[model samples]
Target: MQKEGQKSSKYDFEFKGGKNNSYVFETNYDITYEVKFKPSSYLFDERYQFSSQVFEMVIAVTESKNLDDKIPPDGLIMFTIAEIVTDFFKNRERIIVYICDTADARHLARARKFGLWFEKFKTTQFMKVDASITDEMGVIYMNALILHRENPYFVEIIDAFRKVTGGYSEDK
Candidate 1:
């Protein structure tokens, strides 16, 4: 793993925090979440208690330790996996879920039916992704919550993240 202040080049980063950050295992999912930040994602850390993962460089919130039910959604940053789940459960009407990936139709259909549980999200599209790590294989996804946010409060999460990580340039 790269050390502190190591120049950001082309390295695959997975989303993880808290004690789980110590892990190095990979997931079998296809979607890649491009979590944008203000700068080089430097402010967010384990304190937020968010557990995340990535297909390539894009990070996704898989779990959280600290969660608030009433908070409005911004762009979702610096939060725990618990918070994301709580927010989703609390406001199912306003949130839309998206499960993105580069898996084939058979894999995708199986995942959708056996793995994902959805309450919102009117449509889902599966696309092919080009990841530098493995073969040119990956998935890029765009998902918006059902609730429209005139002012995204969670965007701050991304801002802080870019600051801490030192460089936040991610691929689409």
Candidate 2:
């Protein structure tokens, strides 16, 4: 975690696609990505009464290729994202989750599921339901940042897990 008025955390990482080189590119065999927590809004009152902080969590799948051209399973994707969020935030509060995949656009259903799941998370955590849309990609592009709950800014990224899979999967 960062200080009350500290800047966002910039993180870069890489990992193997999956077993049997499934998620690797046809040529390359690894996935390069970045998860950045950019602070947007700080709650406070007169006298600089800083209470909680809001961050725009940005995740980028910089390099990912599949031998069979198959995107990773939703479960895997959710698990990966959940872990990333949990590890990054580590008990922080007043956070907003944002993820957009306009590059390889999937379906709104995916985003809706993530949103609903986050909504459920709000029941227990400080997350916001209005955030966490899984409809579009690159919503949190390198330059695509926004104030949580502001117009044109309504989404959240997960950084904690009450259970495996973040309790988002209905199959469980």
Candidate 3:
């Protein structure tokens, strides 16, 4: 929307490769993600109450038209998402990642696997995140991953997810 080189002070990140940048959204089908979260966990039970501050980011993988072709054999998207998570941890940012991608089912499954990989990281304070994967439409799915500094119980939820998914538990 900002037309490549134009920078908006209102946004948190500027596109590195202009409009052609893989992260910039072209069609609604492109790789897009939204994050909504709150600073406090007291309203965990009341979902409708804590839906105030939401942050969104787009991650459109380039060089490929279909989902399977876009994902590298070495799992580059997972690695990049991991880096983003680490940056949030270092900055002490509490957020929920809503990944919406028009990729294949395998890619969405991979995202879930990658979310489980977050269990290996432990910050100074008890940090936990429960990543949920759900269907949005055909070839499109949403992964809602929540990170909290105060709740260590998130680790258990992630572990349970990993076990349920059965992909990340293969000892990679």
Q: What is the C-alpha RMSD of each candidate to the true structure, in Å?
A: 18.2, 14.2, 10.2
Candidate 1 vs 2: which has more lDDT: 2
lDDT string for model 2 (64-169, tens) is 6553555453333444454455554443543543444545555355456656544433323233433322225434221111222332212222222112122332
How well does model 2 score by local distance difference test?
Answer: 0.37
In order, what lDDT does every prediction score? 0.28, 0.37, 0.40
- Model 2: weakest 10-residue lDDT segment is 19-28
Residue 87: error of model 3 in Å?
Answer: 2.4
Clashes of each: 30, 20, 0
Model 1 residue-pair collision total? 30
List the candidate numbers ranked by lDDT, top first: 3, 2, 1
lDDT at 70 for candidate 2? 52
Give stretches of model 1 more than 4 Å off: 1-44, 49-99, 105-153, 160-172
Candidate 3 residues 69-160, lDDT tens each?
44334323344445454544443334444454544546666566645555544445533333343445444444544445553444444454
How well does model 1 score by local distance difference test?
0.28
* Least well predicted 10-residue stretch by lDDT in candidate 3: 20-29
Winning model by TM-score: 2
